[model samples]
Target: MRRLKSVVTSAVLAFGALAATAGTPAQAATEVRYVALGDSYASGVGAGHYDSASGDCKRSQLGYPALWAGVHDEYQLTDVSCSGATMADVRANQLSALSTDTDAVTLTVGGNDAQFSSVVQACLTKDDAYCKTATDWMSYYATHQMADELAALYRDIKARAPHAEIAVLGYPQALSATGTCPVIDLGSAKRGYMNDFADALAEGTKAAADKESVTFIDVRDAFQGHGACGSDPWINNLSSGTEVFHPTLAGYIAGYYGELDGAWS
Candidate 1:
């Protein structure tokens, strides 16, 4: 990515010099504004290469939004997504970045609203019966309560960026039910619970997207064989204490950005 940045910068400088000397047509004075709003998944918590300017938000330059912005030079990214952000956080802290001039927006929320991370932690540490009960309750909340909250948040986002093309992203499960890893793999039942949680979130997100007439990018299956237990894991594990159970750098590519590339147009 650093090499790519250098190349793009040099090309842009050359292009500008040529345009200045040859009386070429001018490009837009400002790039198309793209705002990213959501929580840790949107902020790239597990991925390294953090932008220090983002502070504790840990916005990775490799996250889908940054990668998309890097490739599309005509677009300017205002990534306000932060780790531990909820719907409330987006509304209160992130929505200010949106407006009629905003050309596009990508959001990944609701998981934090459902407290899915805490649930995953509990499932990993607690007994099976407790895990089953907590997971089931959280799934129900995600499908029912969190869905409503998301729909309302979508309404607000649409109101703020009336002309923006909005895309709401769904979370991917980080573990596989039948797969195994040394000490890091989730038990089959725990994996089932985690998968169920992801499904419930997806179900709600899809329904809300349909309700608000926006695009919902379902990326659950995109990381199918790349879970923490898979042969080729893209999600971080216990070994990676930075942000365990979250997607790694490769995951932001193949699992997230790759899917967005197809649906974005």
Candidate 2:
């Protein structure tokens, strides 16, 4: 009787041990990885609170990516955006930041390839006619010549990060629709022309996003009343000197970050 009882107790203990082992959960899944790749806009050149480690990339800790990462604790960010990164620059330097493990991406490139800095410089220093002509020429080139390059870049991004959800964030107009305000010396018409150039960039960017079946977050509408000439400008005025025409921290928070949150949510 004693031997039988011991045998029964040992069997029960072995079964309990097996059950406990079976009930142990698997290891927790890794956090989602997010990669940000683009130009000055993404680098937050004018947003202030620049990251100490970013060097000439001038990446701001207050930039939208950082803001987004702050809000999303589950995501790990790899921000490789540089201040003067063109589409080609992205191809050469930034794409490597992405991997199959990447789960999300945001891109704000193509402006430099369109020689957007030159357009802004012309607006700031040249006559209205010169600025207008240059703007028109840039508009034409962006719409016609830059499409293939942008498309290829977008496609490569998709290939590199196959499982990631990509978002192509658009640029805001540097000036309001109709205003003659502080900063750069341009007539209201020239300001309107600058806005038109913003439109051209948006069109090209949207085309690339569509090609990749990615989301295009248009900031123009949200930025309508907050241009450099508006009552409450979110963009840096010419008085900003080296950071002229870039978004202020307000722009990143209220404009860029807001739009990005909506898209992601």
Q: Whose TM-score is greatest here?
A: 1
- The per-model lDDT (C-alpha) reads 0.81, 0.81
Candidate 1 per-residue lDDT over residues 130-181, each given as its tens digit: 8888889988988888888899999999999999999988988877555576
Worst 10 residues of 2 by lDDT: 3-12
After aligning candidate 1 to the native by TM-score, how far in Å is the CA of 169 from where it should be? Answer: 0.8
Q: Per-residue lDDT for 1-265 in model 2, tens only?
A: 3533443343344334433543354323576798999998998888887877789999887677876765565667789999999988999999999989889999999899899988988877888898899889988877767766788888899899999999989999888665556654578768877888988998888887777688999998777788886678889887887677889877887778778877897
Score residue 29 of candidate 1 by CA lDDT: 55
Worst 10 residues of 1 by lDDT: 17-26
Per-prediction TM-score: 0.87, 0.87
Q: Candidate 2, overall lDDT?
A: 0.81
